[model samples]
Target: MKAPEGADLCFPLLLNNSCRKPVPPQSDGMLVLLSFISLLTAALNLLVIISISHFRQLHSPTNLLILSLALSDLLVGLLLMPVEILSTETCWFLGDLMCALYYVVDFIITSSSVGNMVLISIDRYLAICDPLRYNTTVTLDKTKICVCLCWMYSVLYNSLILMDFLRHPDSHNSCYGECVVVLNHITGSVDFVFTFISPITVIIVLYLRIFMVAVSQAQIMRSHIAAVTQQSSVRVTAKKSEMKAARTLGVVVVVFLICFCPYYSPSLMGEVIEDSSSSSTFVVWLLYFNSCLNPVIYAFFYPWFRKSIKLIVTLKILQPGSCDAKIL
Candidate 1:
């Protein structure tokens, strides 16, 4: 059970002064899976980015939220996920400055992703519960401004959380190979309420209201189909479309909560949850794995996403005038 004398030292040259390198069982196998998931997340979110950006018809306000979500997930897959995977198997070879910067980038992307989800729930809530006003209220320009503000808010908020570490990156490190920045209980509590509690509460409540309205409308549509006028039929079709979009996005949100809840469990337990801890590695990866699963959820539920993937895979998107091609 003992690591042979110096086998546990991250820097054997430093002998007693070096931090012990953790030798987790089956770490090689885990690394391989993590690598694959990181690559998959990047590739899948890339498809989403290209699909929404290239298709003119897909440029709705709702799709803009999705585009924003995809951008955050793409950053996770491309940058944060890979770095976390490496950190799990080895010491932080990248300097303390990079370590502090890495966490800042991770927090900003994650908070923005959560913000996009909250925005999406609000979008669906309006579309389903107030269909008549949805278009006017959720205009493209307004949605664009909201998306910018979401990222801006995330950057500002997380910067405050990491301000001490940014100013003194090596303050918490006991040795050269370790990277850690601990927050006080007050900061931790503040982060939990804002990042985990408030946004999640809003998302769940809005979705609940949307769900009730959608069900009631669906029953009404079914019962009155034979006597429905042309105008009534058009309204019914729009309602169905809105309900479908809500349902699809609901799946994405549910999966997000499932993956995220575990990651925050330590916070809920009043424990100091450091990202560099071996105990938190599984939950952290589970959280990052959500990025890979988001695109899969879209492929299963949205026919347009499936079709877009086909066009992209076949290189049909390369032809002139492809942007005008009807995807929906």
Candidate 2:
């Protein structure tokens, strides 16, 4: 997906331009590989979410937030990825109405994924920073309200993109039946601010506060443990739990930054410079890479997630009186 000449942005292609054209028929192999990976990762995450949800023991606030994020990614895998694949093969072919619908769905799901991240970060912040107040602050009612607001915010943010598309006249295409929007710079700038910049800013600030709280709590816990003789083991266990939470949160924040920075950078550039470049294509693919990275992150960086997967896959470990069996 080289930059369409004169367009503000371009879709990311998996392979470099040198490999894009070849005497052999393997030109599109990289795109297919990426699509396959994205689809598989999305499916696995959905399955994990469903398995956890089906079991009553897994019905905690943290798990609920994970479920919400998985659902958002699942929507992207199902609705957006196929269109992206089609667009890679040929110019969009579903005509004006479907194209508009595609754009809306993409924006909504992508925005929702970011929104879920923000909410999850806040949840973790409260849980770690003020453990006593965590339960009261993140009650079922509050969680539901937060989730609803995330969806509502996504809808409102994407509505502008939809409006921009609708306002522009449809293109009488040369090959594909899809209608492409003449990217309006003003609306594009607004989209960048609302969809990318604001949400990212909020996430960074919340995480910073959460980190400070975690550090303070750890210091207090250490002091209490040093003063106690009998409760040392209990304090040690609590400390370990806190460490795990910190590690998981750290991974989430780092991955979010690395995956999203490239995708959003082009949008920022698009606002200032209307010229389309190959960098835009690169950013699009980088964003697509994000959809698949979460499952790997969970399975590798988070011990609890890895244990849950083990329980699901290996029934041999699920003994008659085991905690694993009880979780199932």
Candidate 3:
């Protein structure tokens, strides 16, 4: 696999003329496993989204936002992951046109996931801090607007990649014929800002505010309950519920950081170390892990989801030969 001719000097060292080689066979098994996991996770999340949408009881604004997020993850896992796995395995079997489409879909889904986290954080903050105004402030219309703005902003941010690709198609250094959006240092810096830095800043700030609100609400609720209820069991139960909610949110935040840090850290480091292969196969897999993490995290931290799964399983057992299936 020869590097493309007359590529720009700004291309990463890995894409330089001397670095091109046959696809490594060492990681084929890992790629296949990751691809399979991504496919299964995507399927499960899609089922959850569909089940929640079909049931009117799960129609709250928070669940609606979660369903949207699950859809985005599903798109990433279903459309992008297989292509990525193929590229890693066989050195970009897809042609240029398909690669470009993959790039666009990847950008949209990744951006939407980050955007959803920010929106969810804001929702949690309002629900805890401004409970009196949450219903009015986060109405259906407002939620729609917020979701639209997130998608629009993501589209705009990623449009620059298309523009750059169109302007310098010859400069693409990847053997797969994929558009190398961040070819040079300047473009790489811009990509980091748009994809990593900005989103991380927004997510961190929003979660901080959310955590404060949750803590304050828990304190106030405890005080009110203590004054009204003389029963020790009632106070303990209320405290336990509040603690469980806090733990769930904490798990969400931690999973976000763990899954995203590897990718973003390399982007930041690339600014200083121009010739690093730090963002290689391992880092790519770490980024891909994020799409699979959310549903598992939700199941681990939320009792409702667990209960729903158990009910579905029991129903399936009772209806032994029935083809009817449902996800909860």
Candidate 4:
């Protein structure tokens, strides 16, 4: 039997006020593809979280920052990505209040993700350029504090942004099925400053300094390799490992910038951007897709992540001594 048109109504009891179900992904396979991406993102970031949390050897300060980044990306996958993938959600049935709350959470996660990147850049800068003080300055306890503060500030900042929306959820909704909050030029540009400009400035500056110091160290290493003694060779090897990590994280920062730029471009153009527009929607998902790529980058660059994945899939992490297995 063919279903009646009324059956698609979100609130059948209030047909006049209710929204019909939105169109699904353009192709039948598109939903499958997006759902798979969401699942993969969640699973990969979960592996990163579990790997660092469970392994004794992997509990370094840098890994702690990576763990923080993974947690934020995991939330993006689990909480945000599915929502974005659902037919662009033009016919939002979740109601006005939910829509307001959803964007608040979205902004918080995004802000924290940017904060994590800045923290990672700082960690790498210290590791590469000032190895002697890195350990004392970037302690695990201090990193934990910084991560906590990052999330707390994100919550506070975004909550303020959505304050009016929370109070009057439907104030900006244009139709029965619609759910969106538009930011004016002033708010949008200010948000761009806090969310993009400041953090990106810090990341770029620190990474540039790191790159300079790395090149200088490389030249000196090449010139003095023949004269270096055994004790100094051990130091050189350690520095090389840190430099490699810096380079890998540099890739992550570059990818972050690429994915993030398009999403914030409209604000740069001094125009108000709706969250519901086709172009904005595409860029939103593009950044969401970056969460899925983070762990893939880790798997490619980090041997421990690969080994940990093997152990996790092979069920070895469940064994009694797995925490001390020294995969690194």
Candidate 5:
């Protein structure tokens, strides 16, 4: 139970090769809270997935992007969050291969989430800035293609970024019980640029343009031009719906950036980057916390999502024609 300094050892028989059991970063109450977070995140994202996937009206191009994002967040909750919680209070006894596999999956899911956000921004951009061609440009099939490309690119890119480490999984580990992945400065910086700065720049720019166009359109619509005829009124109503969708998804993007910035701040300050350690405990969980917040955002902003939740909760979603039942 105890090592030479009265500290806990993960593998007592292994002596020098064993890792010291990490000091708990949080109290027992905090661990319980973390457990609650893990469950809530998985549950919320699952509902989002079901809500969008099942409801026929919710299966638009924008919602497809949302579905992609929810899938990535669900993986974060189901796989990464629980492991992170355990690793904080204990050792990674999941073995070196599993460790390597875990980080590989982590990077893939994270990169895909960024890719999904970028796609969402572009979808909103077309909807607001170029409404004339928006329907033709952002079709369900095209959105599905883009989502597939995003995930495929993430897998390929992260595999290349982690190629050396993947081949020699234990090279960075100083002990038997810890799962450590250290990216050289060059690799970390490249990843920071591609995954963080580049995608974030695109998201912010697209949303800013969307905001400007939305405001101008709202002004025009309010100036009585929108009420001139029945057709104009219908068009104005359609544009308003698009604007509302943009606003809701914009909140999702802003929250994502707030959570992700801290995790990548080390690179901004020109420091070494490491994954899965106590030092990064807070930032990592903060990033994971974003997963649960998304569906909460949807619940507040999108009535369809709220209604779907009620149906799912009441088990009415199990009945026939439930998916066809009007949600929007």
Candidate 6:
């Protein structure tokens, strides 16, 4: 049954000016599911954070990028997910300034997460396709700098993209208790190119090349292993390691695209999208759900993550020399 006539107004006192609460067609089960996902997203990414941060062996260039990505995902669960859940059935009582700030935070974290994924693809590409220079070229210090630059670029780029909204916060709002942001044709196109097209292009191309190289390496390793030569064995072992890393990271990239592509489908159609629309809401939550899935993927694929989680859960990580424990 529909809610009673005036029951949906966010501000019953100013019924005419207030936007009605958005009661999405959500079942109680779905609401509970979303809540569980938000909590699980936070918990899973938090484990990744603690696993990578506290473990000395995980302090590598690639893990640093993963850490950066996890941090952004954690923000999604902690900050964005709850807001999204509340938004589904309620009107935005937080003023325009807060709305603008929320978008700013959302854009920065989301963009930075995308940037980090690109960096990870590049890292895997080098490890597989150019193993000779991968170590020197993609060092811990360099990865740290790149991670910093990615976040900085996200902040600056999104701020510029939303400059008008920041200046005139409620320029698009038709009533109180509604949070919505719409990008114009020009700004939307520009954002699509930078945040979606270019990064996706780079990731796809690099992964394709990495896939070919990994396949070739795998075939060579299998064909030559019977020789049992020391040099050949060493080469095979290295290639095998590289291929394994590529496969694991490939799963991550594929999942990222699956979760994110739907969210950007409107922009792909060259349309101005409203964030508050039902389709947009569903896809946005799908995007947030990716954050929860990442650590689960890691647990299934990475032995280190599984071990770390066990130690963390069993309180073994609290030991004085826990950081020195061999995890890999």
Q: Kindly give the stretch of ten consecutive residues in candidate 4 with the minimal lDDT sum.
A: 1-10
lDDT scores in order: 0.81, 0.63, 0.63, 0.79, 0.84, 0.82
Instruction: Give lDDT for model 6.
Output: 0.82
> Cα lDDT of model 5 overall?
0.84
- Candidate 2 per-residue C-alpha lDDT over 144-231 given as tens digits, one digit per residue, 9 for 90 to 100: 7788888988888677656746554354222233344434567667767776788778877887777667667777777777767747
Residue-level lDDT of model 3, residues 180-268, one tens digit each, is: 43435666667667676777677677667666666666676677777565657656766776677667667776777777776667556
TM-score of 3: 0.77
Kindly list the per-residue Cα lDDT of model 6 for residues 136-254, writing each as its tens digit: 89999999999999999999999999999899878777777777788888888888889888988998888788877767776676677656667567676767767775776577767
- Stretches off by above 4 angstroms in model 2 are 1-28, 167-179, 225-250, 270-280, 298-304, 307-325
TM-score per prediction, in order, is: 0.88, 0.75, 0.77, 0.86, 0.89, 0.88
lDDT of 5 by residue, 215-288 (tens): 67666665756556665675678578667857765786679788999988889999878986545888989888
User: Best-fitting candidate, measured by lDDT?
Assistant: 5
Query: Any idea how many clashes model 6 has?
Result: 0
- lDDT head-to-head 1 vs 3, winner: 1
Model 6 residue pairs with clashes: none
Model 3: runs farther than 4 Å from truth? 1-32, 174-179, 221-242, 270-279, 298-328
Candidate 1 off by > 4 Å: 1-8, 24-27, 222-253, 277-279, 298-300
Error of 6 at 299 (Å): 5.8
**Backbone atom clashes (below 3 Å) for every candidate:** 0, 1, 0, 0, 0, 0
Per-residue CA lDDT of model 1 for 54-142, tens digit only, reads 99999999889988988999999999888877777787777888989988998899889889888987897899899999989999999
- In terms of lDDT, which candidate is stronger, 4 or 5? 5
